[model samples]
Target: MTSLILLSGWGCDARIWRPLAPHWPHGLEVKAPDWPGYAGRPSLADPTSLTDLADAMAEDLPADAVWVGWSLGGLLAGALLDHLPAPRALVLLGIGEHFVHPQGVSDTALADFQRALRRSPDIAREHFLRRQLAGEPDPTGSRRALRELLGTALPAPFATLDAGLEHLAHLDIHHCLSAASCPVQRIAGADDPLLAPEVIARADQRIENAGHCPMLSQPQRLATRLASVATAPDAKRPESTS
Candidate 1:
């Protein structure tokens, strides 16, 4: 039987995937892996490189498993695909080769983000929800769900936040995707301002109208797509062919 591992983005806890769990297909064991230095969970110190983080996360995963990751998690998933045993398939949500603004942001924006992280988590959470839901059709409920999830975790440390920002700033996973042998499905929200269609066009499968947090914005749709990918015979193709 295939297993499904859900990886959440930065500043989020496993609760972000709660809505999509129940809808997963039968016979598939689904689990959400928590990131280090968040949710009051134990985390590594002085980690370097996204691949290192991927290795740490892989320690708890089955030898071969399907991984579904969003935002920053998607980048980690891509890195994991580079070194770990091949998964049956991979699903990337709300991100492409990079999660941060590729052209790079102005000092003002960077400072603002740093300030937001340092001064008030509530402020940071609110700003994050706004951006995450920027183009979604029904952002009202989604924002509420995000807030509820945020309420569950402690404020992330500045070190973790800084490391995550650095990772996003330097992230470039297109090569990783291009080298992945397993089938990859890219899911995005039609209104998502973060990842554009052209960015995710490289995916073998694409789904629209689901924002960065599709599990919350469109749980049923995400579950359906994930189930199909898991059961499909061609889900595990070689990187050269995929």
Candidate 2:
């Protein structure tokens, strides 16, 4: 069975992926582990260091597993390609080469949001959670659904959240995606409000009527698409550019 690891995005823990469990394909080994400083996990000495993040997570993230990372998690996953034995495949979901795209969230807007987080974590989190659902067919319904799904989990520590935003602000992974030793696939929400349209168009596949949080808005479809990738024949690693 292919081992599938689901890595959650900013402000979220492992529980964010729970809604997809019932609809998950059988016979595949799946695991969703919390990032450091999430779900009561200890924060790293330097949460902003990709190398530190990789080292802390290496044991739990086997190289053979098909790694699926969403948003900030996807950026971290791409960085791991440089430090760890490459996963069989890496799937980047709901993100683009640049997190702060001109058409998406501008640098100023992102900075303001970061400042808001420092000032008030709860209010910032709630605002972000609702904003994520804007591209869904029924944003209000998706909001209610996500609130229920994520209600049980405590928010990630302020340091972790801030560190993630730092990554978003500075990290650009176009090189990582192109130079990956393993196959790199991209999945996007058809109407993701936070991503530039070109980013969505570049996706290997997309889930319709969904936005940033497809796991909550279109779990079954997302599950089936993921299973297809997990079962497909592994691709040969391309030659290194370095």
List TM-scores for all candidates, in order: 0.84, 0.94
- TM-score: which candidate is best? 2
Q: Score residue 17 of candidate 2 by CA lDDT.
A: 88
In candidate 2, where is summed lDDT lowest over 10 consecutive residues?
A: 233-242
**How high a TM-score does candidate 1 get?**
0.84
Q: Between which residue pairs do clashes occur in model 1?
A: 181-238, 181-239, 189-210, 190-209
For model 1, what is the error of residue 207's alpha carbon versus the real structure, in angstroms, after optimal superposition? Answer: 3.6
> Which digits, one per residue and each the tens of the lDDT, describe model 2 over residues 1-242?
67889999998888888888898777888899889998889899999988898889998789888999999889888888888898888888898766998888889989999999999888888888888889988889888887777783446778889999999889987787777878887889999988988889978888998999899889899988777777883443433343
* Tens digit per residue, CA lDDT, model 1, 175-205: 7878877777776665566665565554555
Give me the displacement of residue 184 in model 2, in angstroms.
0.7
lDDT of 2: 0.85
TM-score of predicted structure 2:
0.94
Instruction: Give the best candidate by lDDT.
Output: 2
C-alpha lDDT values of all predictions: 0.69, 0.85
